[model samples]
Target: MYNKTIITIIRGALGMTDCKRLMEERRSVNFFDAAQPLTPELLRQIVELASLAPSAFNLQPWRLIAVRSPEGRERLWRLAQQQPKVLEAPVTLIVVGDRGAWQGDNPAWGELAAMLGGAEAVKPYLAMAEALYGATTERRIKFAESNAALLAMSVVYAARCFGVEGHFMSGIDFAGIKQAFALDEDEEVVMLLALGYAEGGKVLYPRRKRQSYDELVEEV
Candidate 1:
């Protein structure tokens, strides 16, 4: 039998094998039931889970704008190559990466201090963020974007646990979205995820094939 402690940890952190089944069963649902939209509380919980993803120096550069309103969804629809799913889905999250996350020390360090119990507890982490991620603009931006990508995937996985399905879109007009949303110039739009319940008693196919463990893994 499995250790109860280990099983509890798994379930607490990311839920049981059922959560895995949710991910496996989920598909890139295009036709959504906007009428069956996620409640505000549920949306908050999903985003909360997505935010827990790790980031370099704990900067947590990800910023998600959930577009659930009529006008906002319409704008996204136009920016996203006229994809109907943009309009059909109840919420479309625009995940952005803030390149300037490591530029300063006050707010970020303040958060770290609170999280770690005191300023003294996380002073070294603060210094490390400045030393490593603050080296150059390119480094900062790359770190932010990469971390944001991790958070983006987490959003999908987290949403699935709530019986929500999603489809991530690419080739979006980043510039237009920036202009539309008035995002900071230093913020890069990483990706967009359309989220909602599937419509018309939707059925999903098997998860796409991935490289087998032997094919993708290597031992040193």
Candidate 2:
């Protein structure tokens, strides 16, 4: 007998599976206990898992900067509107989308082509990515931002599986973050995530009401 409910609960706790119950259970966590730091290995695991998020043409056009060092975190804090959560959390991820992925000097083209059967097969895909996302400056940035947004959500859920919580935010000096982080001109910061463990056990806020299926879905 497969107890899916119980299984989901356990797997969700481990951050191994994406279940609706788990998604519903997670809330924006603030006030992380900085004393309870996340190990480097654990942080790596979470990022690697989240990197599996699908992207257009397998470009995976996002760059992640995990500010774990004290000095780095301090620099990031200054750019992030001096948010207390940014300083209190053990790690803060500067998630950005690189619009340069489709342009020249891009390595993803070679990598994706290798998987699908070498350069010949992937040439068209490379062209398509460029044509669609590289049509104009606005289109390029928006397409890149949309793809990176997917990775951001994946990261939030992946953190939950490791008993870690996150608070995703966008209120910041965008230019400051890029300057502090040395982000290239073609790269745009999508969001920042403060990651750490809660001081007490299970400090989940009450689940908020969401749009009903009827309101959310449409039967065509």
Candidate 3:
């Protein structure tokens, strides 16, 4: 069950006006307040909120390694191209995607089946997942990466609701991270997220120009 305090906090922070303001003001913070500490309880709450992100067949396949200790962050810093934020942020999350989550034997399938009605009701969905994601290696990788990306995005936004800032980093030594972390072969490293308060309570640069809707959108 979701925590009532967390639900209240989210409700207060995510009102229409606040939501729009948060979206516009959010930035990929480059400088983190190293002195400011993030409690494990708060971090867990952020992750719990992020878990609400959607996934195909309700098979949520993402995993996270929260590198919070100074030593752990130092190790992550090396793997992440020596990015200072990896160390400066109170926590860095190694987001992983399970490429084999769609398999029939996955426990999530059984749980989903129970929720839907029964095994019989879930058979078609299982077949569809297999047909869409299991036919080729490329398809399975795409499915994992895409769904994990969705979860990662949610993590960023969820952190913001608690006045935390986050930066997404993809320029990392993926192979080294996998080996160092001892990840399973089926787990794909999606991205790294640095989470903490911004140094001096704000970002350094003004918001950059974004493409206009007309340039970015197409009416088919």
Candidate 4:
């Protein structure tokens, strides 16, 4: 028999183990099991989980439009240099991000300011938001794009956790994809994810040698 505290710790450890196992096992599978089609429920769940990813001031800029029709997939395949994986993959996801996600009402910052220094402190924070999100410049564009990229990666990871293989792709004609999908001009595709089961036992190609950790890391 195990003690209560030990049992609780064991449960927590098992949860962490499950998460870590999925992370370690996930791979970028290029070939997919063509027999199965990705379901709406699964797509919804994956997006919901991914929305929890950290964003700048909780601006949650990422949006996903899933292409399920064979015809739509065919069009996407053509846009992606006629990649067979785009056609064979059960689900084709177009990930978009709004460049102005932070311009709207920002309650999180106001709340935090109030918490840290009370109501009077929030006035400056509001001005800061106006300056940062209102002025559209190269620096701000890059900032939003960086956060959107992280959120996109989180979507791939979340899908993999649900036993769905993920392939992050950006090799498509951006204008064609937008026109074909009738996407709004304000929202732009940041990435694409091909989701399905792996075609064979192998989930991915073998890892290539990477730069040394020492060379990549700096303590400046």
Candidate 4 local accuracy as lDDT? 0.76
**Predictions in order: lDDT:** 0.83, 0.84, 0.90, 0.76
Candidate closer to the true structure by lDDT (higher is better), 3 or 4: 3
**Cα-based TM-score, every candidate:** 0.83, 0.85, 0.90, 0.79
By TM-score: ranked, best first: 3, 2, 1, 4
Best by lDDT: 3
Clash-forming residue pairs, model 4: none
Tens digits of per-residue lDDT for model 4, 82-119: 88888889888888776766654546665666565775
lDDT of 3 at 98: 89
Candidate 1 segments exceeding 4 Å error: 1-16, 114-124, 203-206
Off by over 4 Å in 2: 1-18, 201-205
Error of 2 at 82 (Å): 1.8
* Per-residue accuracy of model 1 over 100-122 as CA lDDT, tens digit each: 78755437668767766887877
**Candidate 1 global TM-score:** 0.83
* lDDT winner between candidates 2 and 4: 2
Best-performing candidate as measured by TM-score: 3
Candidate 3 has an lDDT of 0.90
Model 4, C-alpha of 64: deviation from truth (Å)? 0.5
- Give candidate 1's error at residue 211 in angstroms: 1.1
